[model samples]
Target: MRRQDRRVHTYLLTLFFEVLISYIFNQLFYCETSKAALTSMPYQCQELILYGSVFADNLQDLERRLTGLCDPGSTEFHEHDLSFSLRTGTDPDVTIRLRRRFNVDSFTSHQWQFRYIGGPEPDQKCPVIVRKVIDSIAYSHLMMDFVKTLGLRMDYEYIAKGTVWTNGRMKVVISQIQRTEKAGHYDQSNLKRFADSYLVEISACLPDSAEYSATAKQLRDFADQLLPLVEMEKVDYWRK
Candidate 1:
C-alpha cells in the first residue's frame, strides 16, 4: 500500500510538470505568431492635397515665389504617367497610376512609381481634400506585364515635366502637362502640350494617427502667401 501511494504521487507530479511545460510552450508560440502578424500588417496612409493652376504667363512668377516660400534647390523630373483601371460593369472600381521617371538632364537613375489614390470623401467641414493613398516603389521591368495580367486596362496617359519643392512635410509640385500623340507610346518628339496652364499641387501624405487639420492649416497658411498669384484651394476631383 505504501509503495502504491508513493508511485501515485510521483505520477501526479510528473503529469503536472508535463502539463505546465506544454502550456508554457504554447503561450510562447502564440506570442511570436501574434508579433509576426502585427509586423506583417500593411499600414494605410492619407494624402491631403490642395490644387490650383497658374497660367502659362504667370508660371515664372509662381516659380519665383515658390523658391522663396519653399526650401532651396528644387528637384526636377520628366515623368510619364499611366492610369490603369479595372471595371466590373458601371464605373471603374479600381484605378492605379504608374509614374515612370526618365532621367532627363539629370544624373539620377530611372525609376518607376506605383500609386493607388482613393477618391476623397465629401466632407463639408474638412479644410483640405483627404484621400487614401498608397505609394510603392516598383523595380521590376515586367511591371507593365504584371499589371496587364491582372486585367487592368490602360485608361489614359500623359507626360509631366515638373520641379518639386518641399517645406518640411508639405510638398509643392508645379508641372506642365503634355499628351502623347499615340496612346501608350511616350515619344518625346510626338508629345504636345495638354493645356496652357501649369498644374500646381500642394500636398502632404500622413499616417493614420497624424493630425490632418493641423497639416491643412499649415498648407493654407503657406498658400495664403501665394495668394492672388496662385489660388490654391481644395479641389473636388470627381466633380464634373
Candidate 2:
C-alpha cells in the first residue's frame, strides 16, 4: 500500500510539472509571435525625400556632374531631361529643373524625380526638392544613399529642415529647426544671415495601411544613415 501511494504521488508531481512547462512554453511562443507581427507589419511608402544643400560655388560643378550621370553615354546613364521655368511677379522665382527617369532591373519607371531649385546661395535659400514615388522602404534607403554619395562627392552641404513621413492622411514630421534658438545667438535672424545657411526638407508619403511603429523605425533607419553626413545633435530631432 505504501509503495503504491508513493508511485501515485510521483506520477501526479510529474504530470503537474509537465502541465506547467507546457503553459510556460505556450505563453512564450504567443508573446514572441505577437512581437514579430508588430514589428513586421507592412508599411507601404509611396514617396520619400532626402534633402541637402551645397555651397553656391559648387552648384555649377554639381550640375555638370549630375548632367554627366544623366547622359546616355556615361556609365551612370539614366534617361533624363532638363527644363526651366520662371515666375515673374513681386517676388520673382527662377527654377532650373532636372527630371530623371529610372528604368533598371526590378525597378520601374515610376521611380523618378524632378530635382529642381532656384539657386544655392543663402540669399536664394531655395530648397532643392527630390520628389519621388518609392517602390519600397528598402528602396527609399538606397535612393537616399545614392543621393548622399553623389552629394558628398560634390562637397555638398546637407542641412536638415526636417524629415517627414506621411501616409497621405496621417503624418509624422521630425524637424530639428523646431529646437533651435528662438530669439538668441542661434536665432532665425542669425541663421538667415549665414552665407552657407540653407534649409533641407525630406518628405515622404506612406500607405495608409502602414503600421506606425514600423514606419517610425524605417524613418529612424533613414536618419541613422545620414548621421555621419549631418550634425549629430541636429539629427536627434527624430528622437524627440
Candidate 3:
C-alpha cells in the first residue's frame, strides 16, 4: 500500500507541473499576439496641404499675423530630413522620409519621425488632398538600419528651420528650406537657403470617419486669412 500511495503522489506531481507549464506558455503567447495585433493596425490619416512663400521683407508681418491667428506658445525647430526610396523595378518606387530634430527646445528632441506619404488621389475634384500617410514616432535610432536592411537607398537629404503653430486640428508651419554645400553634411553654419522666402504650409491629419466638407471649409477659411502675404492653394506635384 505504501508503494502504491507513493506512485499516485508522483503522478499527481507530474500532472500538476505539466498543467502549470502549459498555462504559462499560453499566457505568454496570448500577450505577444495581442501586442502584434495592436502594432499592425495602421493609422488612418488624411490631410490638406497648401504651400506658398513669404518674402524676407514680409516675414515678420506674417509671423505676427500667424501668432494672433494660431494658438499661443509656438515651437521653433531645426530639422534634418533623409529621403529613402525602395525600388522594386516592376512597380513605382516607394519613398519613405525620416526626420530628426537638432537644437530642439522641446522634450521631443530625441524622437525620430518616420513618414510615408501615398500618391495624391486621382480625383482632383476633392478640395483637400486625400492620401494614405503614416507618421510613426520611434525613440530608438535603430530604425535607420532597419530601413536600410529592407533595400531602401538614401536618395537625398535637406534641412528645414521652422516655426510651428496649431489651431484646433490644423497645424501651420513656416520654414526655410536649406541645403548643405556638401552632400551628407548637416552642419547649420554650412547650410544654404534654397531661396530668400519662407515656405508656408498648412496641413492636418484626420481619421477615417472625419467629414470632408467641414474640414475643407475650415481649411479654406483659415487659408483665406493669410491672403496677400501668402497664397495657399492645392498644388499638383506631378504636373511637371
Candidate 4:
C-alpha cells in the first residue's frame, strides 16, 4: 500500500509539472505574439480620392456596372459590403460605396460617384469620382493595382496637404484637379464642359508609423501610375 501511494504521488507530481510547463509556454507564446503585433506598424491609406470625367452617354452603362457590382447576389461582388444613394433634381448625382473591415490591421473602401454640372451654358462637365480607403500600408500596392483597372488618366494637377503631430500625423489629403484643356472634347479653357472628358482627383492620408518609408514608396508608385495623365506642376509641396 505504501509503494502504491508513492507511485500515485509521483504520477500526480509529473502531471502537475507537465501542466505547469504547458501554461508557461502558452503564456510566453501569447506574449510574444501580442508584442509582435503591437510593435509592427501597419501601413494604410486612411483615405483616397480619384477624380475623372464621364459622359452623359456613358451614364447608363456606368450605373449598370455599379449596380451589378453592388448586388450581393452577383458573383462579381468583389467581397465588399455595398451601399449606394442617388440624388436627382436639376443636377443629378449617384454615389456607390463599398466597405470591408479587417480588425486593426486594415480595412478596404471603394467609392464611385457621378454628379452632373447644371448651368445655363450649352456645355457643362459631369464629373465622376472614385475614392478609397485602406487601413494598412500593406494594401497600398493592391489598391493601386485596382485603380489601374479603371483606365484613369492623370491629365490633372495633384496637391497634398497635412500637418504633423507627436503621436500621429494628420491625415494626408491628396487632390488631383483636372487642368483646363485648350482644345479637346472636354476643353475647359473654352468655358465649355463635355461629358466625355473628366477631371481627376486623388486624396489619401499618410499614416505615420514604422513602415512610413515603405508606405511612402508605395504612395509614390501609386501616384506614378497617373503621371502619364498629369500636366506639369510643382509637386514639391507633397515631399515637405
Give the per-residue lDDT digits (tens) of candidate 3, residues 31-130: 4355333222224377667667899899999989988999987998888888886543322245577888855235244356666665565656666566
Clashes of each: 0, 0, 0, 14
Our tally of clashes for model 3 stands at: 0
User: By the lDDT metric, which is better: model 1 or model 3?
Assistant: 1
Q: lDDT score, residue 42, model 2?
A: 21
Poorest 10 consecutive residues of model 2 by lDDT?
Answer: 132-141
Stretches of candidate 1 exceeding 4 Å from the true structure: 1-43, 88-92, 103-111
Candidate 3 at 108: error in angstroms? 15
- For residue 6, give model 3's deviation from the true position in Å: 71
| lDDT for each residue of candidate 2 in 1-240, tens digit (9 for 90 to 100) | 477775666455434333422343234334535533321112223333344544545444533443342222212222323333333221212332333332334333323332323221221121221122212111121333443332322211111243333333323333322222332233334333234533333344555344344443444444344443332122211111
Q: Which should have the higher lDDT, number 1 or number 2? A: 1
Which stretches of model 2 miss by more than 4 angstroms?
1-50, 53-77, 92-202, 206-221, 230-240
Best by lDDT: 1
Per-residue alpha-carbon lDDT of candidate 4 for residues 1-240, written as tens digits (9 for 90 to 100):
477775666455434433422343234334435533322122223232233333445434533443342323212111122233222222222222323331222323322121111111121121111122222111121333432343322222211111111112211211212222442222223322223433323333543232233433444444344444432221221111
132, model 3: CA deviation in Å?
1.8
Judge candidate 1 at residue 73 and give its lDDT.
86
